[model samples]
Target: MRIAATLRMALRALRRNKMRSMLTALGIIIGVGAVIAMVGIGNGAKSQVEAQIASLGQNVVLVFAGNWSSGGVRSGWGGAGTMTVDDALAISREVPGVINVSPEVRDRQQIQANGLNWNTQILGEGPDYLDIREWPLQDGAMFTDQDVRGTTKVCIVGKTIVTQLFPNEGPVGKSLRIRDIPFKVLGVLSPKGLSVMGSDQDDVVIIPYTSEMKRVSKRTNLSSISVQSSSPEFSDIVQRGISDLLRQRHRLGANRDDDFTIRGQQEIADAATATTRIMTVLLGAIASVSLIVGGIGIMNIMLVSVTERTREIGIRMAVGAHGRDILLQFLIEAITLSSLGGVIGIVLGVGSAKLLSAIAGWPTLVSVTSVVLAFLFSAAVGVFFGFYPARKASNLDPIDALRYE
Candidate 1:
């Protein structure tokens, strides 16, 4: 028989048992849908984490002012102010590929403005801090280098500060009191939603590090330093240069650990995204088990079909249908069922992802690659599980098959 006739016969056979065929395809449909939905959720989470990491700005590196270890005591970074203003200046002056640097100090204070008082984070940073962070001013201008040098009482405010402290008035050109000392608001920072640590990014005020050390916080040492490289390719070089310069300046010997820790943008991003990547793979693996179960269902159903049609197979073989033709007919039926299921499952999966995103407020991203892979895998499952039953039907002796009924 011709290939076309065999395919037609196979399809016709399936149509004769529409309820059974539909029930058999359900397993594949559920399997494909689950895989796509789980993978989409995973990819969405990874993308969100990467976006947050990118918000730290391009080619950025951080220098935290604390030691990782002190003779095996193992005190991690950010314990105390081990870095100085002079250290930040030396990095900007001496380090190659370093384009921008910001000495940092951190504190929390109840700031008052416009007869409204709110407790927010206070940051001591350089004039180049916004530039290094790639953060733009929503209103007015950034405090200049002169402000840092003069230890001026000028400040920048985040959106949350504006909302809390200067709700009815323009924050720029306004005065906000930090630690009972008033500072002129120079600019309003563009709103940043949240940090990777899930803290509000915009609930802060920024002032010159000089003013922070000399006036408000009254500390000589810095909390940390933020650095920006000239380009992405130069980030590693800049990081290395800063490490070496700081080590030499601090006079740490080869056997002794440094007093500061340095982290580049790529390293931070990798660390942040590692959890999401693992979740993606784990979800995908769990969902794949359903596809295996679906394939088994197809195998079991095909074996039953071959048994029920054993006499029919004998009649066909006796008439002149080749064994290969018999095999092709059964194989086509299985493929038709699985391929049809795959197509429907693709639709179901995409719909489920969108629905989840809309209703549950979850981030979901369905990639074309995933859809294509699911479809192809489903079709391959048909071939793999369909072959045995097809081969058994084709190999039956016509005389014995005819006598069995």
Candidate 2:
């Protein structure tokens, strides 16, 4: 009965000062809202980064030409001095963990089909390139080994190339000219969206590696070689095996350093993930400061409230209310104010997350854990800030409080 009476008195006091009560609650509202928004944004960014990494393909390794520096500052691009077709073949024959290998030479040139012309990247690779990269054909077949060996004038186009050059007709058996050199279209790749590096995967043309090296670019050196591992677990082993083979094939002396780099898909994914996570944490920490400021505001307002309600406290005490009863009354009011704010903030946070995901076309996952954490933290702030003021009100001398003007 005493508890019920105290609660009734607390509610009545809040009702008497409607504007003050609302203003006090607003601090908690902003605090909880900020926390929810920050966490949601962080989670959304993480999901986007992971999705982009997954799109590259699983259990894949990319080996490029040029030397890399382990210490001091170096240029962004690094590779062996030269990677030849023979190097790719040797890796395939000698590397135990390598499942498949595809040597490639790339050049950006203007390609024309009929009267339509557009600039696109041209990649020269064997049939195994499509199989190893998991690139599916939309139409026609991939080039055969015979096509590469004979340097056949056959090409495979990406979905973007097909859409740009052959809008009305299928690309299969069509002839596209790359710098006045005509090549028969053997296949077209399905759309594979843009890579994390901002390069369009479906905006290029692919031809037999031999054809591009000998007939198109006429270069003797390979740009890069892509190798697929049998399993994700064997990726490291395959990477090291390829590195050792390249060192041996290149004939690097014992005291001399290697002039090549072997990179695994897992390493790229890890670096991307780590960078994204750090960015998210940094942003979230900055946003959390807003919550702290809001908490301080709550504490300031609650202190003013206790001073303003001193006479009320004296009246309740004179009417047989104990110090504990007064303490419970104020604490309950504080908790109610904070709890209401938490609910409103949760609704706002969820709505904002959904809106961002829809607008940006990125993935956002709002977990139950985030909602619970926000709510709990808001309540904790109320309790922490409300305690001092509540204690002061409870400790007030009834006679002195009542006599105050």
Candidate with top TM-score is 1
Count of clashes, each model:
0, 5
Residue pairs in clash, model 2: 65-79, 65-80, 66-79, 66-80, 67-79
lDDT for 121 (candidate 1): 90
Q: Tell me the tens digit of each residue's lDDT in model 2 across 229-265.
A: 8998888888889888888888878886667677888
Q: TM-score for every candidate vs. truth? A: 0.94, 0.83
Model 1, span 1-405: residue lDDT tens: 787887889889999999989888988898888889999999999899998998898899999987555556776666645689899999999999988999999989899988889999999999888888889999999888999999999999999999888878898887999988999998999998998889999999999999988999888998899999999999889989999998898888999777888899899999989999999889988888888888888889999999999999999989987899889999988888888888888899899999999999999998999999999999998999899999999999999877766
Model 2 Cα RMSD, 1 decimal: 3.9
Candidate 1 runs further than 4 Å off: 1-5, 68-76
Clashing pairs for model 1 are none
- Candidate 2, position 346, lDDT: 78
**Candidate 2 local Cα displacement, residue 34, angstroms:** 3.5
